[model samples]
Target: MRVAVTMSAEHEDARYPYDFLRHNYIVYLQNLGFVPVLVPNGIQNPEDYLTSLGVEGLVLTGGGDVDPARYGQENTASNEISPMRDETEFRLMQCAVDRHFPVLAICRGMQFMNVFFGGSLIQDIPTQVNAALDHRTGTHSIHVLDSRIEQALGIRVWDVNTYHHQGVHTTTVAPGLDIFATTEDNIVEGILHPAYPIIGVQWHPERPSPSPEIDLQLIRSFLDKAFWK
Candidate 1:
């Protein structure tokens, strides 16, 4: 299986070049018997061309925050905006969804997925939610939502690291969306399409003691769907 891992651009001589990506994501995909394709940021025709090139899955890596403008919000100085990466990833998400490509979106990647689907986000989760749990800390517990995300993870409780300032905040969320995981304070930590084989998690599953089985299984789950066509 060929998995196109989206890269976050690094500024070098004023050019968005492929210099950044959580190496664990690449190594994990390779270790799982899949070819790793680095899809750089700021590609104009990311969707049709990459899809045509036989990209079976997409791994949206963590990066700077999505420009609020992408989701109808004003860009704040506080936001680490990367318009180029946002454009590339959003387009990639659309293409993957259109082609039924399995995707693993972590942190910022997850936030963009929600925004891409017309769901709103809490611009600053810490200031807005006022939840008891510290979301920026490391290795916290999460409650799994049964019959949706749990079935996929094959576990109920997960001690995951929290490292995001933004989160999903939609009262009237998109239809057929399933809540797969949540923080102790009831924050959405995971999302899954009701019928599609797509799942988005807010935590970086490829970090710390990475879950080879879970990560590969998730990608393979998508490969199982994207292939055989």
Candidate 2:
């Protein structure tokens, strides 16, 4: 199965050509048994190429911000913002949803999914949702919904890493989305489509020393849906 993982673009003046996620995500997908492809952050029309490759699955890798402009707000602070990446991944994800392909949106990927579904986000989480705990900590734990996320991960409950400032903070949900997990502070961390093999997590599961068991479980669960399809 071809799983296209989105890459992050760096400033022209920056030292590097690609962001940190380009390799990490590819390794994770390949380890999970899929042919990983890194789609550049900016593409004229990503869906066209992805469809041509017969990409069986899509994984919107982590990077940057969703540009508060997307969720109806002006930038009050400076943060990583990429329109091309956002648009490309959004289209890729929409196509995946339209065709019922297995998908996993991670970190910023999950934020875009929220905005794409007409949900708002907390621009600066420090002031928006304070909970004494660190949201950007590389090591953290979350509570997964027993009936949904547990079934998807094939595990009872497990810990995952975190790295993000903006997050979901509301009882309001996006259209046709099911809440799956949250942190101790009640910040929304996981979401699932009503009936597809689609899931999003606010935490990072493909970090340097990730839990291979949980990572494989998540991918296998999504792949299982493809097998039956």
The best candidate in terms of lDDT = 2
Most TM-score-accurate candidate: 2
Backbone collision tally, model 1: 0
lDDT of 2: 0.73
lDDT of 1 by residue, 125-227 (tens): 6677765467776667777765534565576875777687777753524456667778776677877676656677788767773344664554565455532
Least accurate 10 contiguous residues by lDDT in model 2: 220-229
- Go through the candidates in order and give each one's C-alpha lDDT: 0.70, 0.73
For 163-228, candidate 2 gives per-residue lDDT tens digits of: 888787655457777777777777778886767777778887778535657766765665666322
Backbone clash pairs for candidate 2 read: none
Error of 1 at 149 (Å): 3.4
Candidate RMSDs in Å, in order, are 3.5, 2.9
